[model samples]
Target: MLTGGPLDVLTGDYLAELTMLILGRDRLRNPDLGYAKTFLRQLEEGLGLAHERGVRIVANAGGLNPAGLADAVRALADKVGVPVRVAHVEGDDLMRLGAAEVPEVPEGPGEGLPAGASGEALAGAWAGALTANAYLGGAGITACLRAGADVVVTGRVTDAALVSGPAAWWFGWGPEEYDRLAGAVVAGHVLECGTQATGGNYAFFTAHDVRRPGFPLAEVWEDGSAVVTKHPGTGGVVSPGTVTAQLLYETQGARYLGPDVTARLDTVRLTPDGEDRVRISGTVGEPPPDTLKVGVTRVGGWRNEVVFVLTGLDVEAKAELVREQLADALAGAAGVSWTLARTDHADADTQETASALLRLVVRDPSPDRVGRELTGAAVELALASYPGFHVTAPPGPAQPYGVFTSALVPAASVPHTAVLPDGTRLRVGGGAGPGTAAPHDPRLPAGHGTASGADPLPGPGVEPAVPVAGGGGVGGSPAGPPRHDPTTRAPLGLLAGARSGDKGGDANIGVWVEGDAAWEWLRDTLTVEFLRRLLPETAPLAVTRHELPRLRALNFTVAGILGDGVASGHRFDPQAKALGEWLRARHVDIPTRLLPPTPEGNHP
Candidate 1:
């Protein structure tokens, strides 16, 4: 599929937060076994096409051993006879600096640790301090490309850096080109996760054939304006909805922070350029931050969990019974947490309705507490507890948890070095210059309009709409069918599509509509309080909502919901990956006209 051509660069992201911790652990045991071995398999199969078509390849497959990966690639190139010039980027690892040198080590539970977890609880989390790698920028990549390398492998570079580096190198963009860099950042971000920019994980899955979605490509120009597109006859559809979904994925606040420059996502404009092509423009870029982010992983403690199944009448009683039994079985433990989820419906339906689950979790620094004792306590009640006593599954053995700690290091402190195919090493200064660019104006080119003047916030204009009092629905000039009474209730997903994710301990949900009438209805209906009403779980939480009128979207940030992000969150859907879908499933009153027309000419 990659051989179809029509691309300047092909980038792959092979490392993630958890993947880094896992690889670092492996590296501590065997120095040469840290790199992603899958890269070798992929290179062996695809390097020939990449070399033949002259498509530059960049990837961050060098987890903790870029040097070893480079050596392996050299030997593989010889065997394959591809003459591939492979170069690797290094200098993001900070483990050698020791724990004392690290600053702002996240105290307690927040970004990486479990919420309300004590500092001593996570002392074991940092068990084998291997290599703490910082997220590097695109400078190293441009260096390798400039050094005449075809393949550039890196360790701990930001995912988007793969695209940003290639775009920066191809366009000859300097460090001070903030707006252009921001544009490239948007392009890189969209393409970093491959098919995400296409239609994978899209809200409107039925709208396109996503079974075999194609990889996306960014046709970037010197001006930093790029059209996000995929190859012809691809399975996925790329409209404003898909593009907006990808833009809102895993983002925090208005600023999309990166090592190269801070890209203001609010100023971005997504215009449809024919089919399967979205033009990304007007992304304001500011000067890069002085420091780069570093991720450190430590062994926290051992944790184990078991689920008690409650069925039929007195489900609550059944859950309480199990809790009492476990409390007596294992009295001495660091902590024991329990949550009962009522999966049962109101009506007496299938046997599945009797499937409410009561989950019990035990965590301690001592393996014995979380392992045999934790599982044994639950197992002891298998024949002695509640009516129709049964467990969802057998409680598994305890596992050591790793606490991911983050820090910021001076960009200059870490000297990024690029090793070429010929073993010639060159120093690559990280990040860009400190020149701040003006705000982006959608009406004009970024940094060219009123940005230098008093009005620096030149983003999209907020739309004016009257908020309806009861439920949601607006009183305005009807653009679609005549306004119908919003007295009837329907699923919110009928009119809107949403995408959500976690940021640290918080969760962000972006909900959007396609039509003007729907947009007006959503603006008035999907308020913060109303959303809380729909999802009672968020009722007690602090939620802030931001409106993006240009995209007809509403972004809600719910704090402390994920309980210190994905790694430690206790929620069934950790990281809030299904948060948007869950919100969409909530029923809300909607106007008949706002609802889609069925084949029988009735509102769906």
Candidate 2:
């Protein structure tokens, strides 16, 4: 869930380990650093809090740079006057996987610029390596836990381990409790990565002083269920708006097939007990298919890149000439991925079209010929440059870098561990039992208010319910309008799900329940007591949806469950699963479906 980044590095307190893997093309902000460190800080803080609370912590914050990061945590331990143990998950950086080790990786077609492209390479080497990172798992973390280290730092462990490790720490739950582990995994997915649930990206549509939204805080009970909440006073809100946003991001819209398991997002209830508290609860799910999709990157081949600017000549013609030149130089060599793009403005700067700027990107993972072929780009660019000295030029290749993709590895190929660093792992004298390092100063950083912990804060006014959505045992269709008033229905909304829809395609649904009765309670059963008892502590999704008239049918033009990404391969979040299971057991069937995809359209 977290990769190295500023916000993440702070979580080193409690995290026992981390999975810092990066794929070919991803938009994760901290793929190189930010989020990675956040998870690390989680372990550090968690362990620090746990140590104070008398618990152990283990984590893998090591992303692109493990040694440097490990050294950083070691420093924090020194500052806190505690010993920190860092176990490095060695040997998985895919940057080393090259053409020899990975045969399938393509030998790039090193194409150059048409006329003008980019600046020069600071340095020159051989091949070009695509994105690469290791997929270290829980084993090394187990070593850290056993090593008597209060904290553990790792590189590229799976994202779920953030929460899953804690499940292992507290419950001694094995892989058999995969579902439970999955619950914690989802918990991490919601909290650890997003930084603060409601305050983070999810708050985009709503207006709240993000001046400094409350940093997320997770309340982990002995039972192993964690509720995600932020210090209340901080300007941002954690309503259904944000939590649902996190649920859909980068998820490829598949709710069932999540990262670790084909999870099940069941019973989900979001009850705003007071001003800021929203409770999220639920279940994880079934094992994924036998083979996990593995991406391997070795030194594939070499790549030569060049930039060029075209002027006077037609843009298309210049691009064609560059392509033909590179093709001849490649001499029938297998072409890898290569891209030629317009770097600068295509239109004339001030007046009529005089010139255009462009960039050419080429890559081939072929080791032997791949390296030799890489120069093709620079050569072609050099050739083009002779004709128009006006055309700009870019740099050459770097060390031979190539990544190979791997697939279908047996589950056993990777190891699993829910290891905790050796320590008291809990609080000294206490009420809820403190976590590592004297509970991490429990210091509610500035704007964020602490959880009055002394006594329950006085309850606020009636619940501020949003819209309502009904989807339960009723075979994917929405149930008829409930037996409650539209105005106060939300007030009585025991359980409901809602998400706004933008202009046509951009429309979205953040909530999707497993059973109808669950959806019913969400939409029709809001009361003080219901808010208190029924609501969960984490995944506190506050928004609710009620189907409007014309949109009542609830499916896209094509039939499917939730057109919103929730029902896709992504699993039902813990809150939904937990709430859903309870309803399914009750066997209450609301009489409608949500997005039942017709037999022909494969939407769902």
When summed lDDT is taken over every stretch of 10 residues in candidate 1, the lowest stretch is 461-470
Task: Report every candidate's CA lDDT.
Answer: 0.73, 0.38
Q: How many steric clashes does model 1 contain?
A: 7
lDDT of 1: 0.73
Clashes (backbone N, CA, C under 3 Å), per candidate, total 7, 173
State TM-scores per candidate: 0.85, 0.47
TM-score between candidate 2 and the true structure: 0.47
TM-score computed on alpha carbons, candidate 1: 0.85
Model 1 clash pairs?
94-132, 124-299, 125-298, 125-299, 125-300, 126-298, 126-299
Best by TM-score: 1
lDDT of 2 by residue, 1-604 (tens): 1221112122332221112123222213434442254654555445465555445444455555554565666676777766555444433343444433321211111122121211121001113433334344343453444455555555555555555554555556554454565566555566655454665433232345555566664555444455666664556666544554444332322223322444333223334445555555555344443323333333444444445556654666776666665665566454433344444345556422454555443444454454445555555466444345333544544334333333222233233222233322221110011111112112212211111112111111111122122321121223344564323211111222323222111223333332454445334433222322333321223322222111111111111221122211111231132232232122222333332223212211
425 in model 2: Cα distance from truth in Å?
18
Compute the lDDT of residue 284 as modeled in candidate 2: 34
